[model samples]
Target: MINKIGKITIYVNDQEEAKKFWTEKVGFVVKFEQEMAPGMKWLEVGPSEEEFTTFVLYNKEAMKAQNPSVSVGHPSILLSTTDVEKAYEEMKENGVEVGKLMAMPYGKMFSFNDQDGNNYLLREDK
Candidate 1:
């Protein structure tokens, strides 16, 4: 049986660039990176200490025919921050394009867009 939601896969244009963004600013750790089928590259980045998330970006043209999502824009990478205000501030300080922090009925949240136009949500209930 499926015990939990293990991983989510996203496509990006530049693996290295995405890796850096996810790791450095987003606080995930690189788990594995290498090449894949048909001259395409594969990368998986996540939090080293705990289980985070990952996205794999392949070269655009090669992946385009498949209508892979990355060719159009970045892959969504959602995150949860304990302190929404502080988190939004840090993102702004780092030059991250984040939407104004908003409170939701379920929780507090803010949307952040990456270099590639992908929108990610930062939410907290805890």
Candidate 2:
């Protein structure tokens, strides 16, 4: 039985650039990285090394070449944070493109874009 969600794949134009964006700008750490081919890699990054789930940054062109039917578009991902306001400020200061912070009925939330223009939502968990 499926007990937990594992890794989500994110198709990117440049794996290295995506790694730098997630690690340097978004405060994520590289959980794992392996060279899949001569110039391709299987890269994973997450909020921390201890995080249960990680994002796999796959090369879009290579994926398309392997399977034409596979969607290479970015998925809509929602991430959680302990303090949305602080995270927003930090991400902004780190040169991350962010939207205005909004207070939802549940909590504060905001949207941010990666280097490839893929958008993701960040919400306060508590």
Candidate 3:
């Protein structure tokens, strides 16, 4: 049985730019990177190098060419943080497009967008 989340695939117009946004803005580190072809690459990023789950930044155009029926839109992802306030402030200070924080029934949470306009939810892990 599958017991853990391994990787999440996110399609983007430009992989390099997406990598920069995740690494520089979101503070994720590059977990892996390999050339898939002459100009395409298999790139992965996560909160830390030791994290098991990763975000796989794939090329939208290439995926479309490979499989016309493949969905290239971004997936709705919920990320956890120990401190919502600090995360919100850090993301804002890093120039990330972030939404206003709110006190949800579950916890304090907020949303942020990547360079490709992919939205992700960040909730406090209390």
* TM-scores of the candidates in the order shown: 0.76, 0.97, 0.97
Local accuracy of candidate 2 as per-residue lDDT tens digits, 30-124: 99999988987889998997888999999999999999999898888999999899899999999999999999888899999999999999999
Model 3 residue 58 CA deviation in Å:
0.2
lDDT of 3 by residue, 1-126 (tens): 999999999999999999999999989999999998898899999999889999999999999999999999778899999999999999999999999999978799999999988899999997
Which candidate, 1 or 3, has the higher lDDT?
3
User: Cα deviation of 114 in candidate 1 (Å)?
Assistant: 1.2
**Candidate 1 structure quality by residue, lDDT tens digits, 68-108:** 56445455556777788888887788778889888878888
Q: In model 2, where do residues sit more than 4 Å from their true spots? A: none
Top candidate, metric lDDT: 3
What's the C-alpha lDDT at position 30 in model 3?
96
Candidate 2, residue 96: lDDT = 97
Model 1: lDDT equals: 0.71
lDDT ranking of the models: 3, 2, 1
Off by over 4 Å in 3: none
Task: Give candidate 1's error at residue 82 in angstroms.
Answer: 2.0
